[model samples]
Target chain A: MSEHDKNTRHLARMQRKKAVVDTKIESAKISKGLLLIHTGIGKGKSTAAFGLLARALGHGMQAVVVQFIKGRSDTGEEAFFKNAANLQWHVMGDGFTWETQNAENDLASARKAWDLVQACLQDETVNLLILDEFTYALKYGWLSIDEVVAALKNRPPMQHVVITGRAAPQALIDVADTVSEVNLLKHAFQAGVQAMPGVEW
Target chain B: MSEHDKNTRHLARMQRKKAVVDTKIESAKISKGLLLIHTGIGKGKSTAAFGLLARALGHGMQAVVVQFIKGRSDTGEEAFFKNAANLQWHVMGDGFTWETQNAENDLASARKAWDLVQACLQDETVNLLILDEFTYALKYGWLSIDEVVAALKNRPPMQHVVITGRAAPQALIDVADTVSEVNLLKHAFQAGVQAMPGVEW
Candidate 1:
């Protein structure tokens, strides 16, 4: 096609797309807190949650993060956001499930983290709460899905909650307002590349 | 099963898992720069890139962000990171394709952004470069995929590059060390919930 003809066709296509998008944007009129779930056996579930935490912090919102599966306190994210006045971070797990190797201990730790989450749910001042690797707790039956869903349903009206991990339960997905499955197509580790600091940790 | 028996079984299972995971971690000994692509139709593609930017900055690594399809300079991330000492962010597009409605203008903007990207790729001082919404440029044929791939291949040895957008080209994915497809299972906007500041921005 000629350049002018191509440009005209492009303009027409864009106009159509614009109209559809505009209608969608216009239809979305209700504003409220959202429960978002990031799941699947892929990277960036927690990373994306950390990104939301950054955005929340950038906007001067109070944020809380509860690490349910990751036990390490020396992660790059923790080190960076530890001193932020608007942020509260709690690393509750002793380690990964394999490293811990005790069902009772894991359950206890999950319970402790849930206690804190319950408090955050009631605290309207907390704008964003990230439950990192939380799906594992539900998947492994360390926490009761019914109770968790109940608390999420009753969270402060303007408080947003983000849960991240692989294989999120159907119950949680049913309650969540937004759900994104991060599918791993390929990984560097499979090609013998080590996970580097800051980018991976 | 009895609690004691359950505990014993869990321990055995964890031990087996630990052995497998340890083997994988041991095999991955090489450390190098990674090329990661976040694609598919879902939320957090750019948000996850921003998260990586945060992590890079947290570690005091020099970072650069070249937004290919987002023209607005008033995003929460930009507002927050504009003053950071080790970061440079460039928003090159006039707007979304539909909003702009001009192929020539969009192509010109993409070319201009690619120029900056090429410079960053050669600069070893830049530890991380986020090309947000960059897949669109490639998908629309605004830039040559061969040239982009060559530049990425020849980038600084220790510099990590992340490209985020929907439907990343096969050529780009082929060169990427890690690829994550963010699938949209559910969205708040679909349920008539408006996008809010910080969380959705």
Candidate 2:
């Protein structure tokens, strides 16, 4: 090949490399003081959300996590991170939602849950708010999406909120700065297995 | 409801809870060891991975981190983690794959990279091994998956390993007793933004 042709080939390769680099460059800027909602049927919605809380804590960002459906379980994550000086962790739910039936009871508990969330959202000191399993309230029709979104929109500026659960509403998706849909390709439960601690919880 | 009926309901609830809990009791002993790998387009994989390393250090677990792909970045994580007497940190790859696409060079770097991973994996003294961007080797076909798997499977049997990245392979997934996937939804890029310190990196 001619020297000119070799130069052209090099240029093309550079372009291809830049394309990948450009995407990375673009994504790096996506979550500046972001508001993220994690929803899906797959497991680990809570786990992944907590993972972010760890990041925020590592950076000295104050984080508050509200566990809507996991209030009763002795979560390993709670045992590990709840005591971090920068983290404000609350196991503020009445265990799983399946155990709670009466709409009155659920909403009452959600209100209590929302209070803790509101405190975190409004607190200038708290940089990250993890609303664990908050979506299930909307999915079960126990909480109004409009009301929740309004609360989120009106949240104190610079505060990032993370919602974790399945069936995130379109309105939620619309307002979210970032949305991660975790698909369940395969889970141990499908094979007649159960959650394994340190791995599952 | 009558007082007797209320008592009966409460007793039944407790009984049900115990039966469910009994079946779910964890018999496998929980071990505290550490292995961390950070990779992906996301901002904090390395930071978050190292946060866990710090936690391990607090627990007095032996740690060694080898930074691949991001060797020259000199992230604060490297500076902080390396200062701890219990932690060992190495940075390699010089800059990036594109900066030096020579296969022989990449392999040479990878061999050096693997040397650290292999050392931590084998030396019974080191309890935690952080392989930042370790998966890039597998993704690029520079390292065989089976070789990596065998090393991981045999690594200090009780040691805990964390692999963080996008697009982890099926083989890794199979061997991972615990596999957590982080998803991305709404990012700041759509709004034209950048990552600030302590939040991004």
* Native-referenced Cα lDDT, model 2: 0.65
Per-model DockQ: 0.76, 0.21
lDDT of 1 by residue, B2-99 (tens): 99998999999999999999999999998998999999998888888888887878788899999998887767778777877799989998999999
Docking quality class, candidate 2? incorrect
Q: Which residue runs of candidate 2 sit more than 4 Å off their true CA positions? A: A1-16, A19-32, A72-74, A98-106, A188-197, B1-67, B72-96, B99-105, B123-132, B178-185, B196-199
Which lDDT value does model 1 have at A178? 94
CAPRI quality of model 1: medium
TM-score of candidate 1 restricted to chain B? 0.96
- Residues B1-201 of candidate 2 have per-residue lDDT tens digits of 985775566557756776675555443344433333333344334544654555455556677778776655544344333456777778867556665545456767888888778877888887667677777777877688999899988887657676666667888777765444545666665566665433444
Best by lDDT: 1
Spell out the clash pairs found in candidate 2.
Answer: A30-B187, A30-B188, A30-B189, A31-B188, A177-B186, A178-B186, A179-B185, A179-B186, B35-B162
TM-score of chain A of 1: 0.96
On residues A1-201, what C-alpha lDDT tens digit does candidate 1 reach at each position? 998999999999999999999999999998999999999988888889988887788788899999997888777778777887788999998899999998899999999999999999989999999999999898888888999999999999999999999999898999999999999999999999988886897
